[model samples]
Target: MNKNCAIVTGSKESAPYTLIVQTTWIYPGWFAGLMKQHAKVTTLLKFIETANPAHVLLEINSEKAPGDFDFVGIPNSNDRIAEGYAKTAKSLAKLITKKIK
Candidate 1:
């Protein structure tokens, strides 16, 4: 696994197993080569490609973000962080759990 970022996949809610990938985003070209290697490398049971879908992050050919985290910060453009939509929405939907006999 490439050492740049962390990838945690699989759902504890429904999925049967855990498949965490500790690597940065994968490029498509690199992935294409990987698929080639898969043809030669196989196991008694099955091959990796047939088993799992490749998780790839397509690289964009564009200018990089000036600052960290926020994208709209050119010369640190005094921008505010976006509120967590799911957290905020769930917070709104929180009802009292008090159960009367």
Candidate 2:
């Protein structure tokens, strides 16, 4: 079995149901532009094309409200970063629950 499958199954066996969640760069503006400046677009496209129905490529973006916990920025304090991580954990939990069901 593959490393991913072994990690999921805790044995030398494939997972019965695999949900591959790949978190890529933040999208839709400046960060994406920066990424394009560094990486080849063709290579990025080819990498994206590797995903199938079972794969989820999550392109996170900044929150609309700057004060929100999920806002993408260098937080003023560790508490802010912790809050953002908590929000992300909750979101991922919901996503995984939905996918598994």
The top-ranked prediction according to TM-score is: 2
lDDT of 1 by residue, 1-101 (tens): 11212333334545433233222222111113223110111111111232343533222221111112323221212221111222222222231112211
Pairs clashing in candidate 2? none
For candidate 2, give the lDDT of residue 35: 34
The per-candidate count of clashes, in order, stands at 0, 0
Worst 10 residues of 1 by lDDT: 38-47
Q: 10-75, model 2: which lDDT tens digit per residue?
A: 322343433332333322222232231111111011112232533534533323211123334332
Summed over model 1, clashes come to 0
Q: Which runs of model 1 end up more than 4 angstroms from their true locations?
A: 1-14, 24-71, 74-101
Off by over 4 Å in 2: 1-76
* TM-scores, each model vs. reference: 0.15, 0.29
- What do the candidate models score in CA lDDT, each in turn? 0.22, 0.32
Which is the leading candidate under lDDT?
Answer: 2
